[model samples]
Target chain A: MASRLRSTYVLPLLKQRMEMCTEAPYLKLKHAFKDRCVWEGTVEPSGLSERYVVRITYRLGYDPQVRVLNPPLVRRADRPIPHFNGDGTLCLYPVDSGEWTAADSIAYTIVPWISDWLFHYEVWMATGVWHGDEPKPT
Target chain B: MLHVVLLWPTISGMFLIMCAATIRTGMGEDAMASQPTTEVSLDLILRGICERLQISQTQHDLAEERYHAVGKWLDAEEVPRLLKTQVYAQGSFRIGTTVKPVQRNEYDLDLVCEFNLQKDTIENPVILLNLIEARLRQNALYADKLERKNRCIRIIYANEFHLDILPACPDPQTGPECVVVPDREAREWKASNPKGYAAWFLSRDTRPSVFGLARVEPLPDQETVDEKGILKRVVQLLKRWRDLRYCKDPDNAPISIVLTTLAAQHFVYQNSEAAALTAVLDGVLASIPPFGRLVVRNPMNGKEDLSERWDDAAVYSAFVSGVRNLHTQWHALVQRKGIPNITAALEALFGEQPTRVVAEEIGQRIQRARSSGVLGVQKQTGTLTVATAPAATITPVRPHTFHGK
Candidate 1:
C-alpha cells in the first residue's frame, strides 16, 4: 500500500475513530504487554469458557508517512485497535506463539477496518450468542 | 496504515461506501479488508494482475461445487457403511482459505475436511481417510485429488483445495506450539495481525499457517518434517508472545499454542510498553474476541524503540524469549530418531506421558504418511522415503537447511 495514500486517508480515518472516553484499552494492551511492561491479573472467567468480553482503549502513535522497509516500529493506528484488556483480569489464557505469515498480518490492517466477518464473532462469544452450534470437533 | 485511537465512525462511513462499491467490485476489496471472504485456488504462485487478484473469490464457489459433487459421486458406488459414516464424521468436507492467487495455473482444490483428532474415535480418522481416497478417485471433479499411502489417503484436487486428511488434535502435546484453531478463528486472526511476526511469515516464505482440522492428527504428514519445522518455529514465536500478553504461565495453558487471541495480545504488547502491553491487551479486550506474526527487531535497537516504555518492553521481550527458548530446545529434541514423533516430543517437551493409543495412532500416521509420501519416514537404517505419494504438491524441506537449534 502506498504510505502517502495511507497517510492522506488512513490517518485521518483513525484520528476520527477516537472518542473522548479514556477507558478504552488501546493504551492498556500496550501497557500490559510491551516488551518491557510486566503486570499480572488473573482471568476471572477464562475466555475459553463463555462469559468473557474483551475491552479496548486507544492512545495511538502517528505515522511518519515514511516508506519504511523494516522501520523500527512500523505499526499503524488504523491497524486493528489493540485492547489493553488485561486490566482487571491479568492472566490471559491461550498465549500466542509468534509464528505467522505476511498475508496473515494483513488482518492487522483489516482489523483497523473492523468489519463483521471477524469481530461479530467476538461479540457473540462475549454475549454468548451463536456459540453452541453442535459440539465441534476439538 | 493510520494510527487512530478510535476509527469506528470513519470506519463505518468508509466501510459503508466500500460495501456499496464491493457489491459492484466483485471480490469485496473492502470486504476482504473488513470481513473478507477470500477464496483460495490451486496455483501456488500469484502474479500481479487485477484479474489474478480476484481468484480467491472464485475458488470458494468452485470448491463448494466440487465437494457436493464428490459426495454424490461417492454415494453412487456401494462402499462400506463405515466409510460413509466416517467421511463426514465430525464435519463435512469444505473448501479452506485460498493461498496467494496466481494469475495462471493457480493452486487448485485447496480444500479441507474438519475432523477432531484429539477428541474423535481412534479408528475413525484412520478408516475415514482411506475410504475417502478410494471414494474420490471415482469422481471426475475430485478423482485427481486422491492418492494412496499404504492405508492413508492424500487428496490433490484438480481445482482448488489440495487437501491432506488428518485429525483435528488441538492437544498441545505435539508441541505446545501446535495449537488447535478453528477455521473461522484462523481466518479472522490472519486478517487481524498483518505485519507482526506471523504476518511476516506470510510474506517471508511459503508457510501453510496450519492444516485444516483434518490433517492435524491421526496421520501426522511425515513428509512434513519440513512443514513440521516451520510449524514448530511459528508455534514458538506465537507462543512466546502469548505468554507476554496473558502473564499466564505457558506451561499452564498449553492450549494457547493454538489460540489466536493470545497472538493478538502479544502483537500489541510487543509493540508498546507503558500502554504498550496494557494498550495491546486493551485492544485485545476491545476486539472482544479472536483467534490469532513475526518480524525480527534487534534487541538493542528494539529496546531503544521502546525506550519510553523500556520496563514493559523488557518484560514482554523476556516472556517472548522464554517461549522461543523452550520451543527451540524442544524442536531439537523431537527430531532425534526415537523422539521425533508427536507423542515422544510431547513427553520430552511437556513431560506428559502420552497414552499408548496416542503413540500408536501417531505411529500409524507416520507410516501412512511415509507410504503415501506426505511424510518421509526415516528408517532405522537412516534412509528416509516419503509415503504421502506424489499425488499432492507437498514439498520436502531439506534437513541441511534446518538450523535445528
Candidate 2:
C-alpha cells in the first residue's frame, strides 16, 4: 500500500527528501525539511532554523493524520501553534471538505500545504490571525 | 370674571396636551430601545465556551467505538462465563458532562463491569478482580492493553483514549441496587451506587432531556443530544478551569467527582448559562468553610466523601483558592463589556489556544455579519449596532403608564 500510494501519487513530491515506512494498519510517510522562518532560540542552540520531520499516517478508510513529529523547539507562547491541535496533528483543511482524495499526491498537496501552514502559523503567532485561505477544521 | 375663566381654560388645555406628548415620547423610546447596546449576548459567549469545551461528535464516536470493542471482547468465548457480565459506562461519560481533556487529547472513560453474582459467593475482592482480569487477558486484542489498577482494569487504546473498567458485584446489604467494587490497595470491597448516583444527577432540573436516563445505550444522535445546557456547560467550564489551574501538579487537582457533585448540588435552575454558572459557583464557594477541611460528600451516600483526597489543608486550600479565582474570572468575563475582556478572562481560565479558537470563531461571525450588512459600527460614537431594513410603518405603540402613575 505504501509503495502503491508513493509511486502513483506522491513519487514526484518525495523525490530524495521524503521516505516511506509502513506501520501495520497504516502507512507512514515521513519527510525531513527545514523552515527558516521558524526561529530556534538560544535554548535550542540550533540557530534560527532547524530540521523538522513531518509524518503523515494514511489508512484506507480514515483521513490521513499529519503531524510534525519534531515540531519547532520554540513554540508560540510555549503552546502548540493555532494550526495544530493538542495532539500536534497539523489540521491542513476541513477533513470533510473533500478537498483531498486518494488520487491527490500527498507529497505535492499535503506536504506543501503543511509547509504553507507552518509559514502562516509563524505569522499567526505574531498577529493572532490565520491568513491562510483554508477553512479551519471544526 | 370673563378674563379669569378664559385664562384657566387655556392653561388646563395646554397642560393636558403637554402630558399627552410626554407619554407618546416615552412609548416611542420603549419601542425603539428593544435592542440593547450590548448586542453580544451572554448566550453567544456561553455557546462559544460550550463549543470549545464540550467533547466533539468525533470524540463521542471514538468513545462509543471503544465501548463496543470492549463489550465484544468481554462477550468472547475464551472467557469462562461464571456469571452474566454486563459492561456499561459510568461517571461523566454516562452523565453527559464529559469535557475535552485539557492537557492531552485522550479521554478518560469510566466503565463499570457488573457481574450478576452475589458478594457472599465471591467472598474476597481479589478473586473478583482476578476473574475479570483473566477473562480480559484471554482476548488477544486486550491482552497487550490490559492493566490492573487498584480497583479497575485500565485498557489503554493506542494514544486515543483509555477505558477504566471497574468490576463490581451486588452488595449483600444493599440488595441488587447497590454494588461493591474491589479496592486492591485496601483489600476490601468499596460500596458504590453508580446507577443510583447517575439517576440522582439526571434528576436535577438542569439535566438535558437528551441524556434521558439511558444506562449504556449509544447516545442519541448528536443532533438530538443537546449537551449545551447550562448545567453541563458550567461543569465543562469548571473542569477546564481545574485542568488549567492544575496543569503542573495534577495529582493535587480536585477530582471531577468532587467538582461535579458540588456544582450539581449548588446548581439553581436558571435560563441563562451565565446565570446558572454564577449561581453554581457562588453555592460551591459558600459551601467551603474558612476554618476546616472542605467536605464534598456524595449526594447519594454521605459516608463516601468525594473530597476525601482533599483532607490535606494545602490541597483543600488550593482548590478553594482556584474556585474563587475561577469565580472572579467568570465575573470579569460576564460583568465586563467588550470582546477583549471576555477573551482575556477566557484565556486566563482555559489557556491561550482554546481562547484564540473561540476568539477567531467570534471574529468570523462578526466578519460574516459585516459582509452580509447585518452588523454595523457607529463611526462617531464607536458603538456596535445591528442593521435592519427600515420598517414600513413605525413600531406600533401600546399605552403604558409611567410607574403606575
Candidate 3:
C-alpha cells in the first residue's frame, strides 16, 4: 500500500521531465516576471509517467499555454478554475432579476474578453497587485 | 413684465385650455382628459413653464409646439410612447481632433427603438432590427433587398444612416463584466441562478493582478457581510470601461487599447510606468466589436487559436500603438468637445489628476508628460518621443440635421 501510494505520487518526478524545455531559463523567468508566467516555458513534453502539474504564471499579450507539471489531472476540467474562489469573482451576467442565463448572444464581447485575457492576459498569471487606480491611502 | 404672476398663470392656463378644447374637438374630449399631463406632478410641469420663458425668435414661433412635443414624451408614460416613436439617429459615435472640411460630420449614429427589446426596461437591440427590416420592405424604391442579420440587426433607411440597432442586455447584475451579448447562451444559463452565477463568476477566488489597476471583483459580503462591495465592484468595472472608451483607436490598435490607455493614465499619475504597463496588460483579453469579426489573438502559439483572428506582429504593434494613442487622442478630442478643462475630466474619472501632465493634454491639464524619456528614466531619451501619429484629421461632422431637410 505504501509503495502504491509512492508510485502514484512520486512516479512523475521519477519520469525524468521527458520534455524539450530547459529548466534553467524557466527558473530564471519564473523569478523575473515575479513567477507569473503561464506557459511556464516552451514545454513540448509527452509520455511522462503521468501529466505534470506545475504552477501556471500567466502573461499578458500572449497565448494561453498551460504548464503541465503533473496530473490525474489533480484538478479536472469543466470543474471550476482550481484557484478561483467566489470571493474574487468578476464575470458580468444578465441584469435580470433571477438566474443568469447561458445564452450565446453575448459571446462576441465576452469571449473576446476572455480570449484576449487568455491570449493576451493569461488568467493564471497572478502577481498579486491591482493595476488600476489604487485607492489613495488617506 | 405686466405684473402677471397670478395673471400670468391665468393667461397660460387659458391658452392651454383653448388648445385642449381644440384638440378635443378635433380628436375627442375623452382622449384629452385621460392623458398623463393631468397626473404629472409640479416638477415636470416646470418644463412647460420654462419653455414659455425661452424668449427667442425661434421659440416665439415654435415654443408651444416644442413644449407639446417634448412635454408629451417627458410627461407621458415612458415605455409605450417610446415604442411608437421612431429612432432618428445615434449621435457622435466617434471623436477625433484632426481638422478637415468634413470632420464635423465624421461620426455615426444608430437609430433604435429607445427600448427595442420586446419587454426590456433597457434597450433591446433585436426588436429594433425587426422594425427596421419591416420598414425597409414596406417602403418603395429598392435595389438589392435589405438583408436582416440577427447579430448586426441593421435596416437601410433613405440610403443614408443604416439604422444599426445594437442589442445590449442589462442584467440585474450591472457592471462591465457579466454583460450578455447576442450569443452568450445566457437565457439557458441564467435560469439556474443569474445572481448566483454573476456573483460567483466574479468572486474573489479569481485573484488580483501584478499592478494595482486591475482586479477581479472581490468576494460577496455575505461572506464579509458587505453588500456595498458588490456595488463598488460594478462601479469599478463601469469606470474601467468608460475610461477605455474615452477615445477611439487611431491607427494600429492594441489588444485592450482602452484598458491599456486607462491603465497608463492610472499609473502615469502615480509616477510608476512599470505598474502602468502591467495593469494595462492584466485581465485584458482581445476585444471584438459587436459588428465585426474577432481580431484579438493568442500570444502563445503566436497564431490563431480558437477564432477566425490571425496573430501577426503588425497586429501586435497596432495594438500597442492603439493603446498609447488612446491617451493622445482623448487629450485632443475632449479639448474640442469643450471640456477644455482636462483637470476636471481627470478628476471626475481618476479622482485625483496627476500633477505631471502627459504630453498629450490638449485639454488644460497643468503639467504634460515629458516627451523625452522612458517611463522610469527622468532623464530625456532623445529617441523616446511620442510617435508622430497621423495628426487627427478632424473632418466636418455632418450634423444630423432634421430629417428630410
Which regions in candidate 2 have their CA more than 4 angstroms from the true location?
A1-138, B1-38, B75-81, B184-186, B206-227, B376-405
Residue-level lDDT tens digits of model 2 in B205-277:
6445222111122334342224445677777778888888999989789999888888789888765567778
The 10 consecutive residues of candidate 3 chain B with the worst lDDT sum are B1-10
By lDDT, the best candidate is 2
Output the lDDT of residue B337, model 2.
Answer: 38
lDDT of 3 by residue, B1-405 (tens): 001001001122343332222111111223222111111111111112222112233322332343233223422453354445333222111110001111122212333223323334434445544544454454343224355565434434332233344333333333322223343222311111122233432342233221211112232212221221222222232233243433354233322223322232223221122222233433232233333334432221212222322245555545444444544443342332111133234334332222012111211110011111100100111001111110011000111101000
RMSD of 3: 32.9
| Model 3 TM-score (2 dp) | 0.22
In angstroms, the error of model 3 at A111 is: 65
Q: Per-model C-alpha lDDT, please?
A: 0.27, 0.56, 0.25
List residue ranges in candidate 1 displaced over 4 A: A1-138, B4-55, B75-77, B86-98, B101-125, B149-152, B158-160, B167-405
Instruction: State which docking tier applies to candidate 1.
Output: incorrect
Please give, for residues A5-98, the per-residue lDDT of candidate 1 as tens digits.
1112222222222210111122123233221221111111111111212222221222111110111111123342122121221111111211
The chain A TM-scores for the candidates, taken one by one, are 0.19, 0.54, 0.20
